[model samples]
Each structure stands twice: as C-alpha cells, then as structure tokens.
Target: MSRLVIAVFWLLHWLPLAVLAPLGQAFGLLLYVLVAPRRKVVLTNLRLCFPELSEGERRTLARRNFAITGRSMLERGLAWWAGPARLRAMVRIEGLERLNALKAAGRPVILLAPHFVGLDMAGTRLSMEGDFVSVYARQKDRVFDRWLYHGRSRFNDQLLLSRHDGVRATVKAMKAGRPFYYLPDLDYGRKESIFVPFFGVPAATITGLPRLARLAGAAVVPCVTRILPGGAGYVLELGGPWADYPSDDVEADTRRMNAWLEEVIRTMPEQYYWVHRRFKTRPEGEPRIY
Candidate 1:
C-alpha cells in the first residue's frame, strides 16, 4: 500500500500546482468525512485551543485544517521531486538576513520552527540555501520513512540527527555553523517536559529549546511558514533573534515559548497542525485527553 502511495505521489508530481492543490483538498474533504478517528482528534484539539469559538466555528476551522493537511501531504511530491528552480519559485522567504547576520557574526543559531502545514516546504526550501541540522523521528513504516528522509535531505548538506542522538551531538553541530531547525511545541510525554499554559491549558511542552540554546550558546530565531491559498505557493518568514532567552529560570522560559506560540497560532489558526493529540500526556492523576 505504501509503495503504491509513493508511486501515486510521483505520478502526481508532474501536474501543475493549480491543478494539484484542489485535487488534494478534495481528497482531504473525503478524509475528513471518512477518517472518523483522526477527524475527532482534530475537532478535539480545536475545541481545547479555541474555547471562545462556537462549536460550528470550530468545526469549520477543523474542516479547513484537514483540507490544508491534505494539500501538504500531496505537495510532498513537489518537495521531494520538483526541480530546484521550481521550488525556489514556489517558496518565498522573508527576513533571511537575520539568520545570515547571526551566522556571519560566528554565532550558532537555532531556527525555532513550529509545526505548521508548510513546515516541510520551509525546511526543504531552506536546505537549498545552506546546510542545517534537524531531529528526525523514525517512522514505523520503512518505505514511507525512506521517502520522507530522502525528501528532507535531498538538498544541500542537510544533517538529520536521530531523536536518540542526545544534546551533545546537536550542540556540536550548532557550534560547527549548522543552524538547528528545532520544533519544540509537541507533547513528548512527561520526561524532560514541563507543564506550560498553552491556550490557558497545561500542555506538556519539551524544555529542549532553552536547554539547547544555552548549551550551544545559540541565538533562537523564529521561523514560521505560511501556506498561501488558491495555489499561490508558500512564504517562510524568519523573525529576528529572541533577546535574553534561556534565563536562569527554565520553567519561565518554557512558559514564554508557549505564550509566543499561542500568539503566532492566532494569526493563522487553520494552518497549525491540529490533528495531533497535543495534550495527551497529562500531569500525575489527570485523566487522558484522547
């Protein structure tokens, strides 16, 4: 089944974005109706994150999210097999000079990427510009994993460190001039994660952002990717480096991270990855959220 899916992706890569995007969205709408379990997860997440929204409003948002999620999945073909010139034309980057300035000054940097639908597009586009390191979570399926790995690292000297590689290896890579593309928002269980108020709910967010930044003496820069509507393409926005981060208090820094993420998600709630069970790992005697 996986091989057949990959084959389909390859065949679909030849189609223009104008044609491909809507087809993907149509497929997404089908998934929203058929994939009841995942559809529930997306709705649950939206309810938790946006309680002020009416139930109808939340459902509307979830449907749009699933559509974009579908588009992202199908668009992996472009990231994996499209020509460099084609991808460069499709992904527009902003504020890259902030990253360049930090590197030019010999400062190790961390590109703090949130889990947006356009994440892979942003990473692949940046990989074309220079080398960078990111953590890779091995997928259970070998065939799909191989294709995902190849798609991500097919560009310039991209280094994908395994989740088990630990902090020392990642810090070393950062010090050696390879910016770390770090995604620190997901709920990675209780270990090394603190309960931070995300959307006014205690979310188990990993403390790696501040720890890694302090260990590698790297500047933390926000990297957000927006998926343009109507098959227009994507925009990867690189914000200026955060100042006075990783203070003496780790919990405080983690709270700051979550607060910043909440603000960003408000800008484009539909683009955020809401399908995941972000609040799965509850504290102590708390009941399971999923």
Candidate 2:
C-alpha cells in the first residue's frame, strides 16, 4: 500500500500546480469528513488557541487548515522529484540576506522554523542553496519512512539527525557551518520540555531553542514559509536575528519563543499545522486533553 501511494505521488508530480492544487484541497475535504480522530484534534486545538472565536469560525479555520495541510502533503512530490530550476521558480525567498550576513560574519545560526504547512517546501528550497542540519522523527512504517527521508535529503548536503542523535550531534553540525533548521513547538512529552503558555494555554514546548543556541553560540533567526492563495506557490521569509536571546533564564526564553510563534500564527492561522495533539502531555495530576 505504501509503495502504491508512492507510485501515485510520482505520477501526480507530472501535473501542473493549477491542477494539483485543487485536487489536494479536495483530498483534504475528504479527509476532514472521513478522518474523525484527526478532525477532532484540529477542532480541539482551535478551541484552545482561539477561545475568542465562535464555534463556527473555529470550524471554518479547521477546514481551511486541512485543505492547506493536504496541499502541503501532495506537494512533497515537487520537492522530491522536480527539477532545481522548477523548484526555485515555485518558491520566492525573502530576507535571505539576513541569513547570509550571519554566516558571513562566522556566526552559527539556528533557523527557528515552526510547523507550518509550507515547512517542507521552504526546507527543500533552502536545501538547494547549501547544506543544513535538521532533526526528524522516524515514522513507524519503514517504507513510508524511507520515502520521507529520501524526499527531504534528495537535494543539497542535508544532514538529518534522528531524534535520538541528541544535542552533541546538532551542535557539531552547527559548528561545521551548517545552519540548524529547528522546530521547537511540538509536544515531546514532559522530559526536556517545560509547560509554557501558548495562546494562554500551558503547552509542553521543548526548550531546545535556547539551549541549542547557547551551546552552539548560534544566532536565532525566524524562518517562516507561507503558502500563497490559488496555485501561485510559496514564500519563505527569514526574520532578523533575535537580539539578547538565550538569556540567563531558560524558561523565560522558552516563553518568549512561544509568544513570538503565537503572533506569527495569527498572521496565517490556516497555514499552521493544527492536526497534531499539541497539548497531549499535561502537567502532573492534569487530565489528558487528547
């Protein structure tokens, strides 16, 4: 079944974006109806994060998010198999000068990327530019895992460390001039994570951003990818390096990271990955939210 899915993706890669984009959205609509568990997760996340919004508004956002998520999934084919020129033409990168300046000054960088739908699109586009280091959680299925690994590393010199590789390997890669593409928003349980307020709710966010930055003496730069409306493609934006980050307080720095991410998500709520159970790990004595 996994091989058949890969075959379908390969065949679909030949279609133009105008045709593929709508199909991806339709696929998402189907999932929204059929995938009850994930659909419930998305709605639950929306309720927690956007309490001010009406139930109808939250449902609308959830549906749009599913559509974008579906598009991002199907578009992996372009990242995996498309020509370099074609991929380059599809993604427009902004604020790359900021990244270049930091590297030019011999400063290691941590590209703080959140879990946006266009994440892989941005990563694949950036990989074309040069080598970078990022972490990946191994999928349970071997066939799907192999396909995902190849799709991500098929481009430039991408050094993908497994979750078990730890901080030492990541810092080593940073010291070697490969910027770390770090995603620190997900719930990785209680260990190595602190309960930080995300949209006024305590979310178990990993403290890796500040720790890794301090360890590697790297500058933290925000890297965000936005999917444009219609079949227009994507834009990967790089924010200026954060000043005075990784302060003496690790928890405070983690809070600051979550605060910044909340603001960014507000800009494009639909593009954020809401299907994941972000509040899965509650504090002691707290009931399971998922």
Best by lDDT: 1
The lDDT values for all models are 0.93, 0.92
Give candidate 2's error at residue 9 in angstroms.
Answer: 0.7
Q: Report RMSD for candidate 1.
A: 0.8
| Residue-level lDDT tens digits of model 2 in 71-138 | 88888888879888989889999999999898888899999999999998889899888899999889
TM-score of each: 0.98, 0.98
Kindly list the per-residue Cα lDDT of model 1 for residues 1-290, writing each as its tens digit. Answer: 99999999999988999888998888888899999999999999988889999999999999999899899999998988999999989999999988999999999999999999989988999999899999998999999899899988998898999989999999999999999999999989889999989999999999999999899999999999999986799999999999999799999999999999999999999999898899999988999888
- The number of clashing residue pairs in model 1 is 0
Q: What value does the lDDT take at residue 219 in candidate 2?
A: 100
